[model samples]
Target: MDKLKPFPAVPSDGKIETIPFLKACRSVVKLLETFGPVLMPAVDDIHGNVKKLEKIYMENQTEFKYLNGMLLEEKRKMGCHARIALLWLRRGLELFFVLFSKVVEQHAAGKVLQDLRPLIKQAYEETLEKFHGYRTKQMCMGLMEKFRKYKDFLQIMGANDERSESSVFTILPVYLDGIKCSTEAIYNRMVKKNQVEKHIDDAETEKTLTQRELDKIKVEELQMLQTEEKKASQDQCI
Candidate 1:
């Protein structure tokens, strides 16, 4: 390496050498120059494809909304109890869209996982809407729990190498499909009047289990308070 002569005024010392540095820079420039012809065409093709997809999505937006409204109308036709689950589903979908838009915006600006965590968390939190009846609340839980899986998906997406770009290509379809499937299943269970008695029995069983869970928690809390009081007494004696 010492045998190579750097240009005049360039450092000959091992710590600094101009010749190899210039050669490396020239190599990088040449590589890009060679790649330019192939790369530009590919980039243009990708841009065109993206524009087409955007156009299609725009065209379908109205149709999507109409279909969604029809589903809600169907739920409404099913009566009051079904409407309980419907309300949560509507709110959850609204929150998901807003959060997803933010995620897409951040991704478009080339943000990474750190920037995305909060948007995902906000979506998850917002989906947990309040409901009155135990059946309604359970239905809400079932609906939101499906959305909560997206939080886990973000962790998996972080592991993927393509975090810097819009996962819209993958994420959107998966989200839509999951929400659709869950909505259908919940709707079928909640709206079918024939299953009302079965649902009530199931709800009663669930209520009993939930009450038992609350009792256990209270027992544990009471014991913890007693232990603290006993410790205080022992400290005073000491």
Candidate 2:
């Protein structure tokens, strides 16, 4: 049998050549191997001339911006909602530090039965209203959930007197750090979502208006009326 001809070798960085179906299939497979993972998610999101996830992300950002600005102003004005939020966060931090100190004391000075009645009572009272306020506002639900977890931990550890050197006092700081990070993330996301939505809405409105068409119509009508008036005036003069 005669030897089959070798396919032409295309340059590595050049445009792909049009070829027979089988060869094209091989080229597509090679391209997929090269870039599938990098391109798949983007293409999937952009399928059928729709970018649903992108639109959702943009709208959320727009709504978030407006909410964030309003919240900031409310905080500045010492609004009840803002006050409650600040108090809730501050109380959480204070509780963590106080509990941590108590753990340290139990380890070092052998003071295990020291009363934390007043501090815990105060934290509960101050934060109860704030928690309720957050629930009402529909803000900080995620923070509240994390706060509940910390509260449960504190309750479980509240009565324990024996403190091992390897106890998880460090975890208190980690919990507080997580709360701070989550709160900040929520705030930033809300602000960005609000801003993006507002911009999208404004763009859509502007797109629907045709200023050039309206102006041209008005000018043409005025010119036609002016021409009739000029002819009438000439007739009267004659």
Candidate 3:
């Protein structure tokens, strides 16, 4: 059988791919930074439009309410009444469009936030290899720097510092949980592997003991047979 060789040592930090993945994750987050600011302005614009439409609606209502009944009746008796009907229809359409725009903007913003969560999660996971075996200070300081720098993206993603359940801010805990669970799984597997090795060692020891016993039994039988042959030869001589 070939002699067993020792396996190569793994780096304390991680494999060669760890650094590349970390860089990739950083790049992804950086790309997201530009997007959040862009979408925020769109949402603000929608709200502004809503306010303008609301002002127009209120002004139209007030104008109609203040109209003299006699003038209104005179206008109603003529074809000029169609102007009021048209104004009401126009206001209704504007209100509907304003409300619809708000809803659409909200849905778009929400979708962006939802999409950001998975990207954040993936980046967090990618950092795990590099983070492994790091001192608490090193890890915390490094990640904190990143958090501070990219904080705007968080706000843009609708994940502010507030720990709202619907906000992407809550996803931070999910990243932590993933790291913890994966570490525990690795540790558990190592324990099981050690247990398996110990059982194999015990079996090898038992086999050695059984083999030694069998060899001793065979030697004793051979000695008895040789002695019997010697005694029978002497008896034949006599």
Model 3 lDDT-worst window of ten? 1-10
The CA lDDT of each predicted structure is 0.37, 0.33, 0.33
Tens digits of per-residue lDDT, candidate 1, 93-164, equal 444445556665655576554434455445544543321356644453444333323333454334244452
Using all chains and alpha carbons, the TM-scores for the candidates as numbered come to 0.28, 0.25, 0.19
For all predictions, the C-alpha RMSD in Å is: 26.7, 25.3, 38.8
- Over 4 Å off in model 2, which ranges? 1-70, 73-80, 108-110, 114-165, 173-238
TM-score of 1: 0.28
Cand. 1 Cα-lDDT: 0.37
- Cα deviation in Å at residue 176, candidate 2? 4.7
| Better candidate number, 1 or 3, judged by lDDT | 1
True-vs-predicted CA distance for residue 219, candidate 3, Å: 36
TM-score of 3: 0.19
Candidate 1 ranges with C-alpha deviation above 4 Å: 1-78, 115-117, 124-159, 163-238
- Candidate 1 minimal-lDDT segment of 10 residues: 1-10
Among the numbered candidates, top lDDT falls to 1
